[model samples]
Target chain A: MSEDRIDIGGIADEYVLGLLDAIEARQVETDMESDPDLKAAIAASRDRFLPLDDTAEPTVIGDDLWTRIDAALPVQGAAPIDVSRLTANDNRPGGWRATALAAMAAAVILAVALSVNLMRTIEPLVVAVLVNEAGDIQAIVEDFGNEKAAVRLLADFTVPQGKTIEVWTLPSPERGPVSLGLIDDARSVRLDGPALPKPHDSQLYELTLEQAGGSPTGRPTGLILAKGFAKITR
Target chain B: MVTGAAPDDLTTALAACAKGDRTALRGIFDREAGRLVTIAERIVRRRDLAEEVVQESFIRIWTQAHQYQPDRGSARGWIYAIVRNRALNLLRDSKREYTVEDVELLRERDQVDHVMAAWHRLDRTSRLHDCLGALDDTKRRGILMAYIGGYSHGEIAGRLSIPLGTTKSWIRRGLSALRECMA
Candidate 1:
């Protein structure tokens, strides 16, 4: 669709004004994914109304609020590990038995340290936030550097009587859409996909409503309920 | 808006947070939590719920910091968008009603005062101030009521004693005029 064809009858303004109901708002968001002009309009509207946000006087927050937020934060591999205890026993010297025990303990500590380093280094090669046609976030796809990817559903999706939601990714133009796996229901699950190539940034990932068994054509053959472009997660 | 921290600082802080720097997230909280709480409170109208919104918003900022595109919008705007969206969602889900209690009535009246106060606070030398100043009194009030107080169309009509359809048109035309004037 052409940008000029979009009706600019202050729909963006209504959206920013909180006048649109939940469903209408979601439809606007969904349309925005494919319409740059609409997205720009909404962004402009938000920018224009931002000054009103400043009119609010800063409300004093309870001290416990920050503590609660901190506690709820996801583990981002920055957790502190007390290494002092590991070195505390180093200064002690004894017989061969003590030396062997110390060596064993040192090995265990080294293994733990390596695993932590691995955890720090290993992250999803790319991430995608899948949104349904209504623009509501439905699921998230995380493609590891290997032939493994994880799909976590953010919202419940109703599967039809004989339909299943199949996850697909386009590794390259030559290799159209490849099936990662079939989702039985709306739940977080990992897919052991066929080895093709490493998922690149902006790679397409989608969930299509297909037959209960799976797509017979080994490609996306049904309605694409949710889709998103992958973002490189460094 | 005059942020205590510069816009560049917020952008840089977001980048740092994306790199797993917890202290950077803390820096954002220290600078913007109070104002964020206030914004959420305006929409949700409850201290505890507003605080919850801010907390959830900060968490989103932490997790989705990587998604922030510098070319798209200001970091401060992005942060405010998160807070507003969360607060709006909460308000929508709860489907709050405006009661006729004395305190409720007092708060409704204050919404008008808050909106006008914001208009008055806008820098006179700025284009936004000039554009908004150019709007009709009722039209401008309708726009402000929605943006600042998060009032729905029906609520604005009820408060302003106008028909719902009129309220919608006033706001729609008011926004269109504001955009053209600013442009």
Candidate 2:
């Protein structure tokens, strides 16, 4: 770590504070990213200043705050951006933005539809929900590696900040929900069961939002988000 | 819905946003808005302009979320860079050139900024006040301006009415001193 022997500790401090010129600043950023030891040192120095940014404690983002933010946010799922705000400034050439966004949205929608459609058609391993009046949804999974099948469902509720939703595969109608790892929005984690259970009625794939990181006690702390029947649509 | 993408799931979530997952996009916003807004406010120092920066950052994130790769820095760092760059440009554009009066105002504002900044989680300075108190007045001020306010060497020189080279050395030595003392 002779490369780390430079007594330029002061320069690292200056760099973190944005005291360096653009060139020097970029150089430091590059070094920080490329050099792990240097990065660790800078982080140690920078930690001294962390409290400066910690003014707002992790306050419970109000329920209403989410609503307000949601109202202000762009609509989801390939929805075309509503760029009505830019139009009022008829002074500058802002029309290009909306046009560009519309083009992008069009492209993405085409991609998603293709993916969703293909997934449906291929029907690799299918699962369907048979939800009923009692608010129960049984997950019918089909075609795992062999005759085995796995069932999974994402809960349709808040997972709370720093928490994950666990999808449980109940062995029998009266049995407890089996553990399926935490659900992150990264990708749908489809939990596979052992051998295919006799495809019967009322086999549920349920999800409950648990506490920070996840339910420590192996149970739901937040609330049930989604419950669906594993109706494997071949 | 969130506006910005999550750090760990940037690429996937960005892909999802492109796929029209409004909820996914909103998830990004809900996570990082507060930090981004603070960065914007620090750069612009004006509410409306900071808002403009935040709005622009959101729009840019909406479009560029697709290009974000996990191998790069981080979702948070990337979004912050975008927001900070926007805020800086906006600050530069509005011709808010720091004048003598602005300097005085900035100095007065530093106390409150210093107080509130210490409350933040950025970790620029931890136990800094104690380290600062240990230093001489000149060295303490140097650390304060550089770390607390993110001031450039030239600006610090101008504020203290000292030669640029001298200010630079002070900052360099002061940081070293603080490190030694803290260690």
lDDT winner among the candidates? Answer: 1
Which residues of candidate 1, in runs, are more than 4 Å off?
A1-9, A76-234, B96-109
Which residue pairs does candidate 1 place in steric collision?
none
Estimated TM-score for each candidate = 0.58, 0.42
lDDT of 2 by residue, B111-152 (tens): 445534543333434455567667777766766655544455
lDDT of 2 by residue, A69-172 (tens): 34344443333433433322211222222233233334333333333443454443334342211223322233333434333332244445776756555544
Tens digits of per-residue lDDT, candidate 1, B1-183, equal 555678899999999988888899999998889999888877766665577678767777876787677543678887898788777776664342111342244346466666677778766676777888899888888887787777889888988899999998888778878888876
Instruction: Give lDDT tens digits, candidate 1, residues A1-234.
Output: 333533453887787777888778778867876876777777777777777776677877656678757765665534334222222221121111133333433333333333343346567777766765334556777788588888878678888798898999877543457899989876778889899777776676888778898988687656566766666654
- Ten-residue region with minimum lDDT total, candidate 2 chain A: A87-96
Best by TM-score: 1
Indicate the residue-level lDDT of A47 in model 1.
Answer: 73
